[model samples]
Target: MSNSKGRHRKEYHEPKISEIEKLVSSFRSAHGHDKLMDSLRSILGEKPKTLHKAKKEDTKGSAEPKISELEKIFQHFKEIHGEEKLKQSLNEATGRDNQKPHKKDKTKEHNIYVDREIKFKKVKSKDVAKDIINTAKSFYGFVREKLKYKKYRYPAIAISILMGIYLLFNLPLLYMRMNWEKPADTQKLIVKTQETVQKKMADSATLAPGEVVPAESRLIIPKINVNTPIVYANTKDEKVVQDLLHNGVVHYQDTAKPGEVGNSFITGHSSNYWWDTGKYNYVFTLLDKLERGDQAVVYYNNKKFVYTVRDKLVVEGSDMSVLAPTDTPVLSLMTCTPPGTSWKRLVVRFDITDPVFHKPETVTKENVVEVPKEKEKKPGLISRFFSFFMPN
Candidate 1:
C-alpha cells in the first residue's frame, strides 16, 4: 500500500529542480528576479495572480515612452470618441435613423465622403414650401390692392400718349418759335447781310470769264426774321432747286440781274417737301407777321439791295397775274402756305428803296508778277558746267 501511494505522489507532483532552473534562466534573460518568479507562478497556474512585481521590474529595467508619444495616444482616443459623437449627431440631424455604425478604420477614411452623401438627400415636401407660397400670394395681394384703389390706368396711358405726341411733333415747333425773334438793332442786320453777300461773291469770283454762277445765294429778311440761305432755280438741275426749296431758298425767274429794277419774283417750297427738318415748314408761318416798313435785303453779286416790305398777299400758287412785271423795282418772295400744304402761296412784295454795291478787282495774269528763280550751287567743274542761269 505504501509503494502504491508513493507512485501516485510521484506522478502528481512537479519536479522543483526543472522548475527552479527555468525560473533562474528566465530571471537572467530578463535581468529581473521578481518578474521571473511571477512568470514561473503564472506557468504553474497560480490563483489570484498580480502583475505588480512585473510592473516594478519593468520600471526598474527600462525608461517610459516620451510625453509626445503619450499625448499622441491620448489624442487618438479622443478623436475616435469625437468622430463617433459627430457621426451620431449628423445622423440625428439628417433624420437617417437606419444608418449603420461604421467601423473605426472605414469611418476615419471616409468621413468627408459620409458628410457629402448625407447632404445629397432630397428636401421633403412638408418643409416650408407652403409658407413660401403663402408669402408670395400675400405680396401679390398687397400689390393688387394698392394699384386697384389708385384708378390711374387710363390717366397714365393717356398722359403717356399725349407726351409722346408732344415730343414727336410740337417740341421742335415750340423750340423754334422761342428762338425765332428778330434782333433789336436793324443796322447790324443790313451790315451783316451785305458783308455775307460780298464775301460769298468774292469767294466765287463771279466776274471771271466762263465762271459758272452759283446756284444758291443767301438772303436776309429783317421783317419776317428769316436769315436762311436761298438758291436759284436751274431748268436742267432739279436737285439744286429741290435742295434750295427744301431749305427755304426762294426761286426767281423774272429778274436777269440780282439787283435789277424789273419785278424780281421768287418761289419756295412748303413743308410738303420731304425733309427731316424742312426749312420751309415755318417760312410762310412768319410772313404775315412782317410790317410794311421793315427792310428786306437780297444778297447777290457781292452786294445787298435793301427793300421795304410794302404789301403782303396770300394767293393761289397758279396766280400768274400776281407775278407779272411791275413798273416799280420790286422784290417778291413767294412760298407755300399752311406749312405742309401747297394749295396757296404767301407773297411778300417789297419796293427797292436802297441799293448797296461792292466792286472787287479781277485777278488776271497781267496783275500777277513773276518771281525770280534761285541760282544753283555747284561743287565741281562738271557740276558747274551742268548748272545754268534761268530767267525770272
Candidate 2:
C-alpha cells in the first residue's frame, strides 16, 4: 500500500515547484505585482478585509512579506489541486494568456482578408482590360470576314471612311454649339447695337418715301448668344438666298418685316461648309436651345421689337406650312436640325409683345399637353445644301 501511494504521488507531482515559481514570475511580468497578488488572493478565496490589510502593508515597505504570503498560498493550492490543475487555475485567474490567442487569431484573419481584397482588385482590373481588347478584336475580325467578298468589300470600306470623315468634320462644330455660353455683356451689346441702328436711321431720315433704313438691321436672340445683322434678300430664289446668307441671317422679302402684322420669316445657317467665308456661318448653331417663353429681339427700321417665343416645332425640310401666314403677328426663326445636318428644320416661333399678338384661348379638356410626332424626310444632297435658304 505504501509503494502504490508513493507511485501516485510521483505521477501527480511530475511538474516541480520550480515550474510554479516560473509561472508566477511570468504572471507578474504580464499583469504587474499588484494584480498578481489580487489574483492569488482571489484564487485562495481570501477575505476582502485581509486583502485590504495586505495592500496597506505593501504601502508601508512590507512588499517582501506580501510576496511570501502569495508563495505560501500557491504552495497550498498546488498540493490540494495537483500541479496541472493549479497551473490551469492560474491561467484562468490571470486571463492574459487566454486573451492573447484570440487577439492573434483576429490579427491573422484581418491580414488574410486585406491580402485577398488587394489581389482580387488587381486581377479584376487586368481581366477587364483583357476582355475589352479581346471583344474589340473579335468584332473587327467578324466585320472583316463579312466584307471579304469583293462585291461587299469596297462599298463597306468606302462607307466606313465617309462616315469617319463626316464625324471628324462635324463633331467639333457640334461640341462648340452645345457648349456655347452667353457673354456677360450680351445684354449691353443688344441695347448698344439697337441704339446704334436707330441713330444711323435717324441720321438718314431725309430719304425717299419708299426707301428703307440703310440696311443696318440687327437681330439679337439672347438665349443662344446671337447678335447678328438681318440680311434682306430681294428674291426667294434658293440660289440667290443662299448667296445672301453669307452676309448674315436672311429675311425673306415677301414675309412681314419686324413689328409688322404678319409672320416675319428669318433663316440662318446652323452650320455651313468648313471653309465658308463668313463669321455668321455658325451664328444660329445653338438655335435648338431655345424653349417656350424665351425672347428674340429684332432691331429694325429705327425701332426695337421684343418677341417672346410661344411655340417650337421641328418639321421636315419639305414642309412649307410653317412659312404660311398666321392670324396673329409672329417671328419665325429657322435653322437646320441636328446642328450640322439638314435633316429637318427647327423652328422657333415668337409672338410680338407690342400690341400683344398672342390671344389666350380658354382652357378646355383639349388643353392637355400635346407632343407632336417628328416626320422623317431624306432630302437629296442638292436640297440639303439649299435647305438653309428654304423659301417662305
Candidate 3:
C-alpha cells in the first residue's frame, strides 16, 4: 500500500539556481535594472545607487553589467552572505511574498476547458479505397461469426450475396430517379429542333413535297430531358412497335401524328434490362415526373407543334381506349408504370395549344403522312436473344 501511494503521488521540488536566474532577469527587464539593483542593495545593507548618479554614469560610457554578469556577482555574495538570506533578499526584490500555489489548489481554483473541434478529414483516393475494402472485410467477418453455428448459414449467406449483387446493378436507377429534374435551359431544346429542321430542309429535295421524312421527326419533352427521334411505326403490331422503341419513342400507327385531331399515341421504355444493348433502354425512366401545365414539343416534318400536359392517368396494360381518337389534337405519352415493372401503363396526355387549333379541316399540307421505309440492319447475338423476351 505504501509503495502504491508513493508511485501515485507526484513529488514537488524548489526552483533550481538556473531557474531563479531566469526569474531575476525577467524581473529586471520588467522593472528596470536600476530599480532591481536598488532593491537588492537595500536588502543587503549596502547604499543603493541613486537614479541621477546612475544616469550620469551611463552618460560617461561606464554602464552597468548585463543580467548574466550580475547573476555571477549575486552567486558570489550568496556564498559569503549565506544562501537562505540571499533567497529572502531576492524574493523581496522581485515582489514575490509567497511561494507558488500547489497544483491541486490551482486546479480547484481555476477550471480550464479545452474545446475539441471535429473536422471532416480529407484523405487520398487510394486511402479511401483501402478504408472501404477494410470496412467490407469487417462486415463479412461479423456476418460469418454470427452465422457460424446456424443450420441455414450457407443458404442465408447465399441469399444475402444475391441481394447485394442485385442492388449493385439496380441502385443507380434509384439515384437517377430521386435527383431527376428539368434542365435549366429549356430553350436549348427548341434551338436544337430548329437546327434539325434546317438540316432536314436541305435534304428535302430527295423527297416529294407534303411527303413526311421520318428521320426529321423528333419529340422534345423539357421536363424529362427527352430530345429523341420519333419512330413512326405504321402498324399496331406489338412485335414491330417493340423493335422500333429500341431506336426511339415509337409513334403508334393509324393515330393522329402530332398536330392532328386525334390522340398521337407514343410509347417508350421506362426501364429495360441492364444487359440490353439499346441506347434508349432508360429513356422514359423519369416520365412520371411530369405534372400538369408542363410542355411537350414535337418537330413533325418542317413544322413545330407544342402541347401542354393537361392530365395524367395510370391504366391497365391491356387498355386500348387510350389510343382512341379525339376531336381536338392531343399527345399521349405512354410508359410502364412504377418504372422497371409492366403491371400498368402510365399515360400522360397533352393538348395541342400551339397554332390555335380551329377544326380538323385546318390540317395544312405539312400534316400529310407517309409510311417510312424500314431500314434493315442485322442485330448482334445478344440483342437478338434479349429481343424475344419482352415487348419493352
Candidate 4:
C-alpha cells in the first residue's frame, strides 16, 4: 500500500503519428497486405473497421459542420474503437493511411440565404410577367365583349339621345339671350328731350363754324327716325367701337367733329343679329333708302345745321378713299353693305347745304311727350346668361 501510494499512475497513451506512418510503410512493404492488415489489428489491439452501412451520427445529424458519409462513419467508429482503427480502415480503402489531415477553408460552406434570395428574385420576376400577361388578356376580353355583346349598348344610346335633347332645348334660348338687343328707353328720351327743348328755347342762336354750344348736341336723321346719343371714345379699338355702337352710333374718334372742316364721320350698324344689344344698331339700315333731297340735321349750341344728301357709293371694306379729307364741309354717313355683310362699306355723302338756327317753336313737342306704346321685356345679353338660375 505504501509502494502503491508512492508510485505514479500511467498517463493516457495515444498512437504516435510516426508509429502510424511506420506501420503503414511496413504494411505496404509486406508481401501480403491482407495478412499484414490482420497482423496490424492484433498488434494495435482491435479488428479493422469496415463500412457495411451508414454510421449513426450521419443519420442523427450534428450541431457543427455538415459532414460527408465517410466523415460520419469515421466519427462514429472513432468514438467506438479508436482513431488509429479508423485511419487503418481509411488506408485500406484509399491506400493513404499516413496522409495529412486536410485543413477546412471558411469559404467552402454554402450560403442558404444567398441561394434562397436568387430563387426568390427569379420567382418574383415570373410572377410579375404573369400578372402583366393576365392584365392584357383581361383588357382584350373586355373590349371583345363590348364589341360583340349588345346588352349595355341600348342604355348608352338612350343616354346620348337624352343629352342631345337637353342641349337642343336650351341652346336656342341661350343664343337668343346672348344676342338680344337693348331697346331704347323712350321715357328717358322723352324727359331728356323736354328738358333739352326747354333749355334750347331759352337760348336759340345761329351756330358759327366750329362753335359747339352746351344746350344743343342732338343728331336727328328724320328718314330712319334715328334719335339717340352719339357715343365718342378716344380709342379706335374694335371692342370700344362695338361697345359705343351698342349704345348708339360711333362718331369715329380720329375723324372730324361736327361743324368742323374735314369730313365728320358717323358710323352705325346697318344690320346686325336681330338679337344683338343696342337700340340704334339698325339705324343706318334705312339710310340708303333716303333720296338725294333727304336731310340730316345736327343741332349744336342751340343752333341747327341741315345737311342734304348729295351722292351715295358702294366701296370695298378695305377702301379708305372715302375717308380722305374733303375741301368742303361734309358728313360721311357710313354703314356695312348689303345690310348684314361687312364685305363692303356703303357711304352716303352729305353736303352742309343749309346751315341755319331753328326757331324754338318748330322743335317737335310730340317727341318729348312720346313714350313707347309697346311694353318690351328687355333682359340685356349678359343678364340672360345667368338670369335663369335666379328667381324672377
Candidate 5:
C-alpha cells in the first residue's frame, strides 16, 4: 500500500476562467488583427509559411516548434493552476516517458484532434478546461487566417477574394438583374395583350383613355425599361416623407393626375442604400439614361396615358421649381442626381404628345420618331492634350 502510494502521489492545478478571459482581452488589444492572425496560423499549422523557411528554421533551431496559442493559453492557465499541474498536463499530452504500447491507434490528422481510434488519457477537470481553451484558440486562429492578408496565398482565400472582386466589378449588371422591371413571360404577355387590344379596336378615338389616376398608379418607360408604382406623399411626417425613398415614384397629392391639364409631378428613388427594399426603391436609378423624345407610359385606372420626354433639368435637392404648377399638360419624372446619393435631384419633363385614347394600331414602329442619344465625337490628339489640362 505504501509503495503504491509512492508511485501514484500527485495533485494537479486548476485554471481560472476569468483570468484567461482577461488575458484574451488584453491580447486582442495588444496584438490587434495581426497577432490574432499569427496565432491562428500556428493553430491551423502555419499554412502561409513556405517550405524553405520551415527547413531553415528546422536546421537553425532545436526540435522545439514556435509557441502555439495553446502554449500561450496554458502559460496563463499555469499561473492560475500552478507549475506542477501544468507540467503534468504537458507530460501527459506529450510524454517524455518510456513508451507504453496500448490498444488505441493515433489519428492520421496532423492537427491536435485525437483520432477516434485512440482513447484519450483520463484527465482531471482542469485538463478538460485546458482542452476547451485550446479549441477556442483554434477557432480564433481559423478566423484570423480567413481575414489576414497572408490568407491570399491559400487557394480558398484567393478564390474567395477573386469571386468577391468579380461580384464587386459587376455590381451595375447585378443591380439591373435584381431590379428587372418585369417578369420575362409577364412583360411579353402585356405587350402581346396590348397589341391584340389595339388590333381589335376599329377606330383610334374609341379606345378608352386609361383608368383614373390613383395613389398607387404604375408608370412604365419602354426605353429604359422602368415600371414602378406611384406613392402619394403630401404630409410632413418624417416617416411618411422618407417613404419617398422606398416608394417607386412619389407624387404630390396636390399635383395633377396623368390626364389633367396641369403638370403631374412624380419622383422616385435614384440613389440610396443598395440593400433598401421597396418596390419603388431605385425605380428611377437609370432615369438619367433617358434622352429627349423617349416615351413614358402612365397606367392609371386600367388606362394608359402616353407622354414624350422633351427636356431634363438637374437642380439642388431643395429646388421646388420642378414642382411649380404648369399650364402645359406635362409629366415630370424626378430622381436623385447620383445613382446612390441625394446631393441633387434630376427632373425629366415629358409632354403629353399622344392622346390617352390613341389606339396603337394607327401607328407604325417606323413612323414613330425617336431621338437617339448623340454620340460624342472624339477630339484629335492636339485637342485632347489641351483638354487634359483644361476643359474643351
Candidate 6:
C-alpha cells in the first residue's frame, strides 16, 4: 500500500522547470503569436520585461489596493448610469414646475371678478351722494331761467287768449256759409217775376217776341236733385245760382231769352271757397249721367218749360263753338269740365217740349187768350222788389 501511495503522489506533484517552460511555449503559440509583445509594450509604455518587474513591485503591497481599484471601477459604472437617469428625471421635473405656475396665474385672474364686485360696493355710497347733489343744482338753474323769461311769457298768453275769442265768434258764420240753405224767399221772388213776364208776353200790344225783360228766374231738375233760383245774367255779379238755368243767365248775350227759340246758355262758380263742402263739388256729376229721356224743367214768369235731354259732350274750354246757338229750340247747360279743373267744359243740351204759362186767372197752354181790360196788373212792382232779396 505504501508503494502505491508513493506513485500516486508523484503523479499529482507540482511541475518541474522544464515542464513549466513547455507549458509557457504552448500558451505563447496559441494566444501571443501575433505582435503580442508589441501590444504589451503599447499598453504598459515599456518592454514586457520591464512591465513584469513593475508588476512584481506592485504585488509587494497588500491586497487592499487591488480591492480598492476593483471597487472604483464598479463605482464608475454606477455613477454614469445614475447621472444619465438623474438628468432625464430633472428635465421631466422642470417641465412640471413650469406648468404649475401657469395654472396658478389662471386661477388668480379668475378670482379678480370677485374682487371687482367687492370694490364696487365700497364705491357706491360716495357716488350716490355726489349724483344727488348734481341733480338738485341742475333743477335750480332751470327754475331761475324760467323766472328771468317771465316778461315774454305774459305776452304769449295774451295773444293766445285773443285768438280763442275771435275764433269763437266767427265759428257760427263759417258753419252757415259752408252749408246750403233752401232759399224759400228767393223761390217766391222768382215765381212772382215769371208771372209778370208771361202777362206782358201775352198782351202783344205791350211786348214783342224777341224783347227780354230784366226779371229773375229759377230752374228745378228733380232727377239731378237741383232746385236753385236763377239770377239775372250779369258777368259783374259774383253769386252762385242754384239751378242749371241760372248758369245760362250769365251767357244771356249769347243765349236766347227765356221765352225764345235757340240755345240758352249759363255759367256759375262750382267750388273753391270756405263755404264749399263739396256738396256742389260735382253739381253736374248727376247731370253727366242723364240719359236721353231725362227731363229738365225751367220756371220763369210762374210758368214751367219742360225739356228732354238730347245729348251731352265734354270739350276743351278753348273750343267755345259748342256754346254757339244751334238751329233747334234747345236749352244748353254749360259747366267747367273735370269738376275741379277749368281746363275743359261740359255742355249738356236739351230739347224743349210743351211751354206753359201759369197766371192768376188760369193755367193756360202755349196759346195766350185776350182778357178784358178790368184786371189789374197781375204782378205789381212790390212783388218784384221783394224778389230781389231771394237766395238765388
lDDT of 5 by residue, 331-377 (tens): 99887888877788899999876564333353323233334344445
- Supply the global lDDT for candidate 4: 0.64
- The predicted structure with the larger TM-score, 1 or 4, is 4
> Which candidate would rank higher by TM-score, 4 or 6?
4
Off by over 4 Å in 5: 1-216, 234-238, 356-392
lDDT of 4 by residue, 1-392 (tens): 75653442222234344544554554345323554455445444678553223333332323222223223433445555687776665465436643578885434323333454455445555576676565566555544545454776676678879978886888977676567566655552444333333222223335569876446366778887877666666887878788788877777877777665579888889888878767777878887787898888776545566788998999998888888887566888889988888888989988776643233342534454656546667765447767643525
Q: Score every model by TM-score.
A: 0.33, 0.37, 0.37, 0.36, 0.36, 0.32
Per-model root-mean-square deviation over C-alphas: 34.4, 34.2, 35.6, 28.9, 39.9, 37.8
Q: Model 1, 372: alpha-carbon shift in Å?
A: 71
Name the best candidate (by TM-score).
3
Q: What lDDT tens digits, residue by residue, belong to model 1 across residues 161-269?
A: 9878865775666445444433332221111112222211222222336644434466677656677676566553546666666666656544544466467777665
Q: Considering only N, C-alpha and C atoms within 3 Å, which residue pairs clash in candidate 2?
A: none
Candidate 6 wrongly placed segments (more than 4 Å): 1-216, 235-251, 273-282, 356-392
Q: Write the per-residue lDDT of candidate 2 for residues 54-146, one digit (tens) a residue.
A: 333224332333455556657666766676787676666456443554343656644654565455545555576676565566556556655
- Please give the distance, in angstroms, between residue 315's alpha carbon in candidate 6 and its true position after superposition: 0.8
The lDDT ranking, best first, is 2, 3, 4, 5, 1, 6
Error of 5 at 55 (Å): 99
**What 10-residue stretch in candidate 1 is worst by lDDT?**
186-195
Clash count for candidate 2 is: 0
Model 2 vs. true fold: TM: 0.37
**What is the lDDT for 237 in model 1?**
52
